[model samples]
Target: MEWVLLVIAGLCSGIIGALVGLGGGVILVPVIVYLGSVGLLDGITPQTVVGLSVIMMIFTGLSSTIAYMKKKTVDFKSGWIFFAGSAPGTILGAFVNRGLDLPSFQLYFGIMMVFLSLLLLIRKHLKPVHWFVKNGRKTTFEDGTGTYVYGYPIWFALLLTFGIGFSSGLFGIGGGSMLVPAMLLLFLFPPHVAVGTSMFMVFLSALVNSVTHISLGNVPWLYTIPVIPAAYIGAKIGAYLNHRLNSDSLVIVLQIVLLLLGVRSILDGIM
Candidate 1:
């Protein structure tokens, strides 16, 4: 029965991932609470839910990361650089979630979701800016080649990455909700490329965190295993759909979905 529920969680999350480049944290975390809280598992608690949730994210991220990589949409340099901070931050977040209360977690998680979704909506409107050097020359944000600053050094990017990683690890997500918007807003990454790169970071970073989750007995493989194939398929389809749908409508839908999921999780956790 637990296995069945986990499989459902994975499938649902995969479908959402296909659409929004997330593993469906807003959706899955709530459902996890609702389903597992009703005497579904022995010794049920918020920490247990969080632990298992983070564990599942590792696999979910791994599945989608492959698809994003195949599409050639990943931004490795930025992701790797960010991982320097994110990797450590994620481990720290896991510890925080471990010690937190249920209602507070739910409440904070929903608030964060609302915040992140709105930020994403706003990011769609931001225009790219030209770069300037300390030398005070009217230099473009791009290199002399007129391309966007892919390898352009930005010390602030690491700070942003660390923040994103912390949020992801704390919430048991890939942080696409946070990452996609941040990358788009700050780095001015193309949306498609940002989604792909975010997925890559999710996979690698979550994979590392999964080891810790397992060591602490927080992950539930029975539930996480079934969703693997579906998550992969969903990621590819989402990337394909990126070309088909008008991005505005898609993002709007994603925003609503995440908001509702976050709110629902909070409500469920409260009582």
Candidate 2:
């Protein structure tokens, strides 16, 4: 039964991660913590939770990237550029994660969740930065709707993804929550391209993060058995749906869920 629940959690996280390019750690971390709180799981700590979440993200990112690749949605050049910044940031964040206790970790993670939810809420209302679009490296993408051109300054992108990667390593949330919004609002990336490229970056960052956590003995190998495969399958499903469905409604739902989870985490930390 416990394994079943873990599998379900992984599936849900993978689906949502691939669907929105958030890498599903947002969902998985809270669920794991909740289960631990309820005595359904044992030996839960901030580091272990984050470690497990990053490990699961490996499969989530890889599976989704493959699916998005088939659709020609991934921007590999930008993805590589983003990775250059994220890799070092992830290593730094993993080191930082070792210093956090449960309450502090919960508090900070809750704050992050709330911020990401709000970012998504206001993302559509945000406009692309004129400077980035005008002066940055330009690229074009075409979909059924039309042709879209978008770009960002290389220096700014590096700085931004470094922060994203740091957050991913610290919280195991895959950094997509921040990256997708930044891409869409500041860089003028098409929505599909933003998500696809975000996953690619997530994959690379997760690889760095997982390695660091593994070296630190943070991952609980037994707990990861069910999650990895389940998340992989779920990511495939989500990528398939991304091609056919309107994700605006799903984003709204995810925002609400994240908001609720954020509040719960904050209260848990406080009490």
TM-score of each: 0.81, 0.98
RMSD values for the candidates in order, in angstroms, are 4.2, 0.8
Compute the lDDT for candidate 1.
Answer: 0.65
Q: Rate the local accuracy (lDDT) of all candidates.
A: 0.65, 0.93
Name the best candidate (by lDDT). Answer: 2
- Scored by lDDT, model 2 comes in at 0.93
Model 1 TM: 0.81
Ten-residue segment with the worst summed lDDT in candidate 1?
A: 132-141
lDDT of 1 by residue, 53-160 (tens): 555555556666666667666777666766776787778777777777777887778777778677766776876443412222221233233554433245665666
Candidate 1: lDDT of 86?
Answer: 77
Candidate 1, residue 232: Cα displacement in angstroms equals 3.8
The CA lDDT at 14 in model 2 is 95
Q: Summarize candidate 2's per-residue lDDT along 195-269 as a digit string, tens digits.
A: 999999999889999999999999999999999999999999999999889999999999999999998899888
